[model samples]
Target: MGTIYRGGSRGALAGLRRPHLHPVPSVADRLNAERHELAGAACTAADPEVFFDGTQDATDVAKRICGGCPVRARCLWLALEHGEAFGIFGGLTADERRRLRRKGVSAA
Candidate 1:
């Protein structure tokens, strides 16, 4: 068994155990970390056609790659928040994000 302490907070650590008090990263912070990792990769060998060929298939491939990512949701949230109009985020293609925004608007 471990002990948990509420950092920098008085009395917040009371009645808590260490193993149960884990820190969780915020979505924006996590996405920022992932962006750094994904941005430096070489996109040259990647099929430009797959992304730029003006086809849904290209977006599909992009989404597939995002799906495998661990920080997909965070990535998507950050992109949406920042009004990112391109690239794959949160396992969703640009088109998907557009649709999501549209849906949100319609719902409201």
Candidate 2:
């Protein structure tokens, strides 16, 4: 049988890499994380493609869904703060969000 030895020294750990420490989550990360826990959020049940499709028809449909969304404000704020340049968020297209940002709108 091979010999088994025990030592109090940390020499065995010398070649092991230290655990990587992640930085604090950004605002986008926190928003998205909380979004999942949000009850009655409109987008939870809808197809994701509706928001990403660039067609006007899709935009109309997405906007309609967001019209009465309980969390629309938060959704819009997340997209706006993160500078998301694509998709329909909180019933507004990327261009619309750009306009709002230009006008100094920080939240929904």
Candidate 3:
């Protein structure tokens, strides 16, 4: 591109290397998935910080979002499964999850 001195026949970028392209397949295409478990979750479009800010306002906002989430149960199970030590998930705070764990309450 710097200098095409002999440009009588060749067009622009004629000397450039044409790299091979491999387009990435979509999630469903790759996994044969119908849809993600959290596709309809309310929190997907919300501010991510609201889930992990560790502030009362953030926790409240996150809980409100999780209140109507279709995947709330799955979210809670994942949170408890991983033994998450912080933030809000499935409308519950870390303390709430801790108490549940203390009571030997498994996600069912």
Best by lDDT: 2
- Model 1 vs. true fold: TM: 0.46
**Which pairs clash in the backbone of model 1?**
3-18, 4-17, 4-18, 72-90
lDDT of 3 by residue, 1-108 (tens): 132232122321121111111111221121112112356767656765666567888888888888988877877776676565655667888799999999997654
Stretches of model 2 off by over 4 angstroms after superposition: 1-37
Candidate 1 C-alpha lDDT tens digits along 1-108: 333334232221111112124332222232233355554333323443343233678777855666566655555666566555544556666677789998882211
Model 2 sits at a Cα RMSD from the real structure of 15.4
- Residue 97 alpha-carbon offset, candidate 1, angstroms: 1.0
> Model 2: per-residue lDDT, tens digit, 1-108?
332222123332111111112112322232233445556777666665666567888888889988988978777776676666666667898899999999989854
Please report, as a residue range, the 10-residue window in candidate 2 with the lowest summed lDDT: 13-22
Residue 14 shift from truth in candidate 1, angstroms: 41
Winner on lDDT between 2 and 3 is: 2
lDDT for model 1, please.
Answer: 0.47
* Candidate 3 clashes between residue pairs 3 or more apart in a chain or in different chains: none
Model 3, residue 84: C-alpha shift (Å):
1.0
How many clashing residue pairs are found in candidate 3? 0
